[model samples]
Target: MDSPATLEHYKAGMLLSGAGDSTGFKRELNYSGPDIHEAKKQLGGLKNITVKLPDWSVSDDTDLHLATAEALATGKKGEELLQEVALHYVEGMKDMTGREPGGSTIMGASMLKPGTEGGYRIPYNPESGGCGAAMRTMFIGLSPATLEHYKAGMLLSGAGDAIGFKWEFNYSGPDIHEAVKQLGGLKNITVKLPDWSVSDDTVLHLATAEALATGKKGEELLQEVAFRYVEGMKDMTGREPGGSTIMGASMLKPGTEGGYRIPYNPRSGGCGAAMRTMCIGLRYPRPEQLSSLVAVAVETGRMTHPHPTGFLGGLASALFTAYAVQRRPITEWGLGLVKEACPAAKEFVKTAGYAVEETERDWGYFTEKWEWYLELRGLSSGTGPVVWPDPYGPAERDKAYESFSWSGWGGSSGHDAPMIALDALLGAGSNWEELMNRVAFHGGDSDSTAVIACCCWGLLYGTEGVPPGNYSNLEYRDRLENSAEELYKLSH
Candidate 1:
């Protein structure tokens, strides 16, 4: 594993670079000719002068640092690096307060303009050797290999979800039978047993991968792709899709006026929403893009779960997954990101007619309840007691489960399942087997929680960390691998 300190140092260095730029510009303001000095002198020799500071924001140096970091994280190199940096550079300029960048930085960035015919060349300006470029190169010192490893880890997570679903819940429904029939008979299956089959989670993930591969923007495209998958599932199996799929399929049905905005069941808050959000998180690379990411996640969730809790559950899952894939220190920043994304989640929930008072209280209560549950589970941070003395042995777990649902099926609720999955991931530490075991055996929607938890485990540790036995028996193993590869390609 790469040292967290090293990542933190690079982050701190970038911030320091920005601070240096701010200080340098501010100091220069202090020496703005004798006329300014005279004007200050006329103000009664005020030694303690308060001047309105310039924006004091980071400059193109920080901009280049961020862009380069993203490029490196996504495995861009040579011409790819140049193109990515060029695009990010323009985006950085547009993001700037006044749409201006340092002349040298702009010149170097402009060399890789769109439609420019270039094989591969260093984007440097001989005329300009400003400190901007040199100072921001600290991030480049971090190994690209580490980022690649993280990507592999994320893909493995997707695999874990799909395969884990198969291993734990075998095929019992018409959906599984149809899938098996479509892919030759059980006799043709070599690695997979007849009973092993994937769920809507994997199907929806592949749907997302196909959509992203076509270069479509997230929101509408992802939702459409998800609906198509749901519709396909409905067509294949002459049964109403269970859990959140029922609501999603209903919403996707042609409405009274030839539209797709049919009202869905707001009461549905199943784990399905969170289970399928990993693909969305993998597509968008930055936190600044969180709003759009959350938007798409909500739309995807709206297919089945229009409730605020449902949307927030999906958003939270994607945020955590994205942060994990980016190699953010989970123990340090995971909970913080969840908290940061909560306001947006609440607002999304509010749109579902969740009372304002209830929205605020629910989020606050959920956080508190989650923390309390973690404490009870003997988890201090992202690591904890490896083997929880069977949760069923103690009445406390039963009571907690009942608090969420009367049927002891807490994992059926979108909010509850994600919380449980997050808890499982945090407490599992590096023990992938333990994570899988705990989630799979937790009972009541265990399959859903297993998928979510296993996905998180994969994000933290690559496929190498997962036991081969877990995925080897999956019927759609090849498809899962292909989907993961496609998602990885598009993400990069």
Candidate 2:
């Protein structure tokens, strides 16, 4: 290893700053997160380690301890023969996301296939909600390398959800490809958008409108537009923030017991709003609007979540992401950003001593007990009808929140959801072996968490789809390209 100096390898580039306290607004905050400096030290020792490729692993030397172990394998860096792992990534989950199977939610999984004509198709079914929109948003960072492209990306991801499939398959399904074609805004293109691609009327039209209005309103453009567009999520069925959204955060109104400066999260928090955060790059200026994302998203959280922890949960997620990419592997890094970002996220949650799991996967188990913790233990029924219940005070018998609740965590939903998302990306580990150890036991929404895991894994790999069996999904290629393009534009 070399000296202990720190090196920040960003995907594109991002600023790391401590978001200011509830006071004067500071445009650019450079916060590296707690223990981040120490994390850098661990990274220093990492260079000395050599990653051995498995005979069959997704990313060399699969983190075999946890996951079921994929058949794919990778080779040494700089080797001309390193297996193309990113390709299969998009392949495995495409069709699984359809309404019939994957249906109506990003929390569902989809399968990807390669073919002629249009390279990709929705294959599975259409899903609604900001989570699907957000998870599929990788392309957003790709095509849109500028303000203009960012708008287009947002339109496609968010607005696409307005449509409904099933029963009216032809009208709804066929239009999905058309929506992508238009929202991709790739006019006069011989490359037809192909067929079978799933999209929604809400995301399509809303994104289209945003594309048109981008830059028209100056700085606050994205904030206003994305906020407007995200409202579409309010209509998506089965979508609601879990109660853990406010379980243990500081900002819990006042007299909060057990050490709460604030309840950190509010009951209204869900993967939905954070999913909407991806499109934000298109709407807001970084470093500048970053804090606003935390602040305004909180107001939005209050809509359904009476608890502040829910708000903090979303806030922490976005902030950590905007901050943690500073250390992604540029030379030969692991797909650890998801892992790093989640724990780093606790810096915000720590305000409430919300309890950060040993790792992101542990959150899976903690989440299992989530609803049990909230309704039975956290929420007290005595005080009737709290719009936003503060989980502080004497473990209270009050209900400043019972009536105004958005929805319950239902235990089942939260448990499986995050992990499914994890599997979707599959990058939880430094290698395949590690990936398994981290994801397989993931509680609650196994399928959905896997979906997200795969998606996040795909993020580390950028536009590359998972290899062989899944890669050539033509439709996947197109959408992946489109999504990446959109994200690229927003970064600048």
Winner by TM-score: 1
lDDT per residue (tens digit) for residues 1-492 in model 2: 121112241222211111111110110133654455455456574343233323111210011100111212232232111122223334334433211222333232233232323323335443354333332223223221233233233322221121111111222212333443464422222221232222222232233234323433322442343344444444434323233322321233312232112222323334433333333323333444443444433333333332433333333323323322222222111122223333333343343233333222234433333233224322223121222224322112112111112242211232223322322222233342233223222222122222223333433333222222122332234443454454444444
Worst 10 residues of 2 by lDDT: 18-27
Candidate 2 lDDT for residue 215: 39
* lDDT (tens digit, per residue) of candidate 1 on 1-492: 233344567678767666666544444446666766676577665444433345455555666677767767777667767777667666666655642466776665555464365622335457786665675567765542234344444344444454345433332223444444575633343333444455566556555556655666644575456556555555424221355665466556432332333354545556667666766766664666676667667666656666556656677667766676666655533354345666565665567453446445544544555555555555436454433544433134434544554245656666776766765676567786556544544444555666666665665666655546555566455555565565666656
lDDT agreement of model 1 with the native:
0.56
- Highest lDDT scorer: 1
Candidate 2 residues lying further than 4 Å off, grouped into runs, are: 1-78, 81-267, 279-293, 296-306, 328-427, 430-443, 446-452, 463-483
- How does candidate 1 fare on TM-score? 0.57
TM-score of 2: 0.33
Model 1 stretches with alpha carbons more than 4 Å out: 1-191, 235-241, 253-261, 332-334, 347-407
